[model samples]
Target: MNTPPSPLEAERTDGSSVRIGALVPLTRPGWAEAGRHLLAGLELAVREVNDTGGIVGRPLELVVRDSAADPTRAAAAVDELARLGVAAVAGEYHSVVARAAAARADALGLPFLCSSAVLDALTEQPTDWVARLAPPQSRGWQLYADFLLGAGHGRIAVAADSSVYWATGTRILRDHLAPRGGTVIELDMRALTPAAVCDELVEQGATALLLLVGYPDPAVSVVKAVRRDQRLAEVLLGAPAGQPEFAEWAALLGDDGAAVPFLRYLPERLSPLGTRVEKALRERLAEAPSFVAFEGYDTIAVLADVLRSHGTDRARTAASWASVAVDGTRGQIRFSRTPGISVWQWAWPSIQVVDRDPAEPDRFRVLHAG
Candidate 1:
């Protein structure tokens, strides 16, 4: 349960707080830590903005709502934020929730910038008021395919849960693999036990099994099943984000989780701002921040610029967001017109393949940069 937000006086006579709204899964399985990291990033951005004279000399505020990681609830959250008359809205880690929020933002003609959540279909047809900061899933899948095929692994078996994020990401990989001489034996993981999926992949001459299940339960099932099977030594395992994004994933698999490759956008080097952000996160949250946290901070920073330039004018902000390019934590932050990659998607994105060895469970090594 959440306490009601206390009304604050706007600096102007209008009595608005110059607020930005957030939709995040504050109370959902597999998302609590992620939500905390995102909220931390957002709060940091809000503080920084306010300290630096704020937007038009008014302190910025955030009105956050729990998304519960559901599409319908996410949409409702957007509607509620719209009713609050927020100048802009952002923050979401799940693609399903992002898709709903994006659509609702479009309907309301509110400026919305998604923090994280990458599915190509989210931006396949661009909306006037919505854009995403993360690269689309197709871009991530392309990096994964290039890495696998380049490493002499072509006979790959892909398995993903029925969730929209995993399904779209797996299909993108399947599409890319065929043209590159890599064969994909697809496994639709709908209630099928990990043992069943692994048996089929091993039988089909699969050299590697790619698990795109966003949540860890299904991923754990597949990995645990594979480790228990006698043939595990013969096949490699890969996952989106290179194992799970959390340390708990390492705690769960322990030794068996070693050497599994996954794509992650961690910069080969952290910028000065990145260093400060990480230090702040550790000081406040007592944990090292993930790439997701950087994303959240950058999104709010960009939106703060929009609100500063456009002054809460939705039409003006939406029109100017694409042209408002600034260097962010990873690299240059800009939208492009590249085909297949959405008009709003970032172009020239690169990701590193990372793995955690059983001997060094907490450390991740960069295997390849794609």
Candidate 2:
């Protein structure tokens, strides 16, 4: 649960105000930490906007609803928020939840934006009221695949969490790797434990391992398992390990040469628009924040930009979602040919494997910054 908002939820009282609602995953399993981070980001955005004079002179007011990460619950929450007469709605990182929220937003003819859902399907689908703020998983995968192939690593083994998210990434990975003369040996296993699967990979004589798990807990487990044996340490850990959680895992593993190149957004290096976003995030989240906070801040940034540009009208805001181009934390963001339906595009982060240092117990260094 997040900190309770004050009684004065609305920022301005004199004239018409932009009342936007957000459907967030605040208590979902495997996403509580992310949810909290997102909520913090949203709060920072709201406070900053109100302090600086909200959209169009009237202050911005947000009505928040918790989705619990259930698609059905997410759908219900969207409908409830709509009934409250919100001009637009935004969602968090999970593509599944984004899809579910988009369905409801489309049905209601409401403007909706997703901050972190990156499944290609979200943009591929035909819709007039849905948009995404994160690059599709496919795009991320393509960037990852090209980097790995360019580095002279061809033969690869893939170990992915059976979760739907990882499965989507696997498909993208397979599509890209298969065409480049690289063979991916995919292992169907639980992401929770990597030791068991790593043992099997060693027996199978795999030279490089790709991890397709999204959460940090499973990622760490898998890395520890891979490094259990000296031979396995010499093999490559696949691209998914490039996520910030991998840094935490590397610190915990205390072993060298276990990380493989992977794809992710590089917030530090982006265009001018990207720089503006970075500034906003740093201002909002004064303390060190997680990736999830970036997702949340980006979500509000998109909505606020659209709302401010389109006169705070739901229909116009929907139109602005299609027309307005804003810089996301990752890269340039604009709706796909359709109106409310947009997806984020970004440069993927890639890193080279260097000898891991055992002296540090909490941080690991990679050759590249991704």
19-41 per-residue lDDT for model 1 (tens digits): 99998778855376778878888
Best by TM-score: 1
Q: What is the lDDT of every predicted structure here?
A: 0.77, 0.64
lDDT of 2 by residue, 139-246 (tens): 666667676677666777777766567787878778898877876777876532576676777777777777766555566667667766776756877655344433
Which candidate leads in lDDT? 1
The alpha-carbon deviation from the true structure for residue 359 of candidate 1, after best TM-score superposition, in angstroms, is 2.9
Which 10 successive residues of model 2 have the least lDDT summed?
Answer: 344-353
Taking all chains together, the TM-score of candidate 2 against the true structure is: 0.78
What TM-score fits each model?
Answer: 0.91, 0.78
Those runs of model 1 whose alpha carbons end farther than 4 Å from true positions after fitting are 1-16, 241-243, 341-343
TM-score of 1: 0.91
